[model samples]
Target: MKGNPSLAVFGDWDADGIISSSVIINAQRHGMIYPIRGQAIIEYEPAEPVYLSIRLDEIGCFDAIAILDVPVIDRLLESMRSYRARCPSSRIIYIDHHISTHEKIEDLYGVVEEPLVGYVPTSRIAFDRVVSLGYRPGDRLKLFVDAVDLMDRGAMVPENMKGLLKIVSSISKALSYKRDPALWRSAVDWISSPVPLSSPIAGASMEEIARLAAESEKRIRDEANILAISAQKLGVFRYIDARRRWMDRGASALASMLYRKLRAPVILCVASRDRRHVLMIIKYPGKAYRVVKMLMETGIAVSIGGHSSLGIARIPVERIYDALEMLRSSAIY
Candidate 1:
């Protein structure tokens, strides 16, 4: 309730998350949200177990904090508690749409002032929440949110499609190819600008995004081609062991392609960079949550998160065989 409050904005390191953070920031800049005197914009990788990039102690204190498109994980819960204890009066607003977070909504309420977790894209949810505060967004911002909604929802667009849809897809693919915090921040700045539709995703120009998208598509195709040959049919799912391959990036795209090619659910397992954990990317037709729940219940997955038809799990590298056997016996068709 201060005259000019300081705010901190944290978003996941993805197109949807970046755009969602932009929606709130743009609202504040236009006097739609509170008139903030100062702010911090930080992007984080939600898939990681720990958010080492964010230093709560260094941030000092804030009037409010808005977390966008980030899942509710154990480490995040601990961090939020620490921040809450440090600044008891600070308002915290957490918003996300991942199924994993939705299942733990009760826990979220204990840490943040407002937890806007739902089934739609976080960009749309953020836009709607801002609108509910009696501020109308511009046509460009609305269009930008719609584009992110499509991308986050896994809407299929034709490869030759032209115009905004194609441009949005290219930007999403480019973001998926690499994890660049600077690039993500640039995207947020671009989205918050006046002529967002006219501008590229900040650090990367349109031509550069196109080049990255092309390269990403090729790498996905190459990885899928190799994995397809070694894919194992386990019960109703097609499992691929990707331990020998480096696929920290573009795992989602690779899984989607394999899903379409195999005409069945696809599970790709890749070892972490440190080789301490196994990352399982599951592209199930409609039972991704069930699969993830099973893994968690069986005590095989250390962390699990994602959407309805897509899920990601982290397990110890040694438990890979146990996870596969559990899935094989569950008959999760």
Candidate 2:
């Protein structure tokens, strides 16, 4: 490793991604994995195909690139290969716990660390990795990482940490609704700073997050009611077409809300903004990947990803009905 190496950090747009990126940044600041000389070029959720290439070009080259919590999709793999060809010496480390990444681990062997199987969040993975490499996080970052991990897994926070969890959830909801890269970056910086996770961080302030969460909750509550009323029962699975709703912004939250309301497995079919494809967000107790596999095997899904209890699949809009039928008939669930 070179002394004072330049670095590039990329993370998914969610709270897990933001907090995981912060772990890496904190490690670099402490001169742990690599002695980072300058501020790393941090980016969140680089847009696919178009923006990815443009962003890579803008980043030029770095001595190392750290990718956290981002799924290893085909398009992203292609872009990473192109970047590698252009900068052969730039070491790239991808850390993710998505079942999609786990399925493709062989192809991504050298670049990706062995993903922790099941519900572990990428922030926990990143923190553990840095710790194994001799980087110890402070009390605040550790608590924040715990909050992110529990929240990502849809688990309840301890009563003592409920306040911290609320702050984290508020920020996550704000980011989901706002979809602002600057806010994401601000969140990473906030988590990396010495400010306690319980304290209201500036830039991505508590007031702003609260306002966004409130607005998002209002719309999501209305949409949830609609989904509850119209959700189709397919065997043991409940399916709802969320294409016409304003759900692209809060799809995750909406799915979670519906899951709780239905008290059974729910699948949401949300259309992409560009209408390029439909996203199937599956919320199941423990077999979400089974649903994704069935979709892939039936050729209903073009791409499949996500966790054991929550899965995401992309399929052609024309085959949405076919997918519903297959899930309706499948015995896997």
Candidate 3:
């Protein structure tokens, strides 16, 4: 089995995680033929211990496993050797940007991939990586992926109705119906819609986008208000006026900082759509750091305060339970 190839992929769960896995799988599906089988373990911070327990046992006889968007953490690479002892046929290939300390792990494949945004989620990375792998999707498909990536990354969307709907449907399906990779994307029509920036659902343009954002802001304040108040009150929220810019990332970055410093949920931070800045504080009080990881896996941004502790991320607004359920399902969050 050493010379023969049977490949698999594993990644950290985040928008990037989903997209990255999709890239590898899409590449294989489209004739890249590198990976024949795989499973992605989504988690906040890649929860090295949990991934090791589950994926280690699962890879008993595979020839290769591709690790993406996940952190191997200190000394975990040494343990890979332990796994290889039993399944000596296996080789590990890493395509990630978050590794430290190379001690203890012997001979493996490594490919560091960058995020469109500062450490963009895995899905966005996956979309571009798939293209780099030589599988150019149709314009519509590309637009759809781009739109979702933008939303997840808190960047701007192109003012195209078709792309917007495709993204909304795809994400909604993922959250509501468990649709994987939007197998039904082709059936959706891509049409251009004129949206004002100030509307509740603006995309690429500032006029309609502002309108959309205004509405979204109101909705969030009304429903997910507790989290929004954190940014509003503390005045720590950074808003990017540039379209396709990384607004969601700003929110995640804020969450990480608060978590590392406070280690509790007393800070209710509001991470809203880009095009404007928001600032506040509400009431989060538990392990605050875990929220970003959990939210990223689902391809959503986390609101500070109880929203993070509740395991709810800020996206779609209709699926608060979905995010909560995701966190509850995980042992760490």
Candidate 4:
């Protein structure tokens, strides 16, 4: 293209997002990857994927961009269209594992797309993509990817999965607080090398994660017992108010704890953080592909997306009870 082309890389704040962006960045840095229509190699910067939706006006400056691990495809269409109009030849690549409807993908044209939209983690997809392009990351990186996938998918076997999850949890808990983009980059770089999982590169991250995990676990242990006695049950689902003495830990960890303690096929945790808004996290078994569609059909949720096992949504505070009732009766799950 013109001078050194700018390529903005947007990824979510999860381990999958961090690794996905890292793979592309490492490949580009080693001259193993290049832009589609540029003579000079591309220079990229990492950004939170939500920025593209909230700050659409700033997208035109980049000659090429890659989005990783972030789903909300409908929110991105307008910005992608704007950028495409501004720079007709610019490249747009989107890679995600969130299940998206076919209609959403059809709205965009001329964008390079690789959406697994399955149970697979985005990091695995990134790994395969990089390998297809002839870049081979070390085995440690593969182990790191498998750890994240197993943890996310709630795999509890093979013995080593538990230890691997502890390491991933330490990194996740540390990242959840500050979420400095540099920390994610450092994690990618560290795992890309020969460092073992127990290396001191993590510093006190494991201790911090343990503290947070313990607090959350204790809360769940206490409250889940109360919920089992009090919560209304519909079929195999249990509806629990998640606000009671709940710590501000990560949602995945909380969901996992709730599943183990409650022993329910589905656990819907509803919390009204403020009088103006209500937040909910639904942890369910099987593929919940129709849950979002059914929830939005009720005109209750503002937004919702995640894996089939876990989902997060926002609603009006006044409608919390109504939303719960709707969810109970909908039978979408």
* Predicted model with the maximum TM-score: 1
Candidate 4 pairs with clashing backbones:
none
Candidate 2 local lDDT, 36-59, one digit each (tens): 445454434423233454566566
Task: Please list the Cα RMSD from the true structure of every candidate, rounded to 1 decimal place.
Answer: 3.1, 3.1, 14.2, 4.1
Give per-model TM-scores. Answer: 0.90, 0.89, 0.43, 0.77
TM-score of 2: 0.89
Please give me the total number of clashing residue pairs in predicted model 4.
0
Q: lDDT value for candidate 3? A: 0.40
lDDT of 1 at 267: 91
RMSD (CA, angstroms), candidate 1: 3.1
Q: Give the 10-residue window scoring lowest on summed lDDT in candidate 1.
A: 40-49
Q: For model 3, what is the alpha-carbon lDDT of residue 163?
A: 45
| Candidate 3 C-alpha lDDT tens digits along 75-184 | 34555656667776555555543312122123333322221222444445555666665566445445545655675545555566554544453333232222222221
Clashes of each: 0, 0, 48, 0
Model 1, position 243, has a per-residue lDDT of: 80
Error in Å for residue 231 of model 4: 3.4
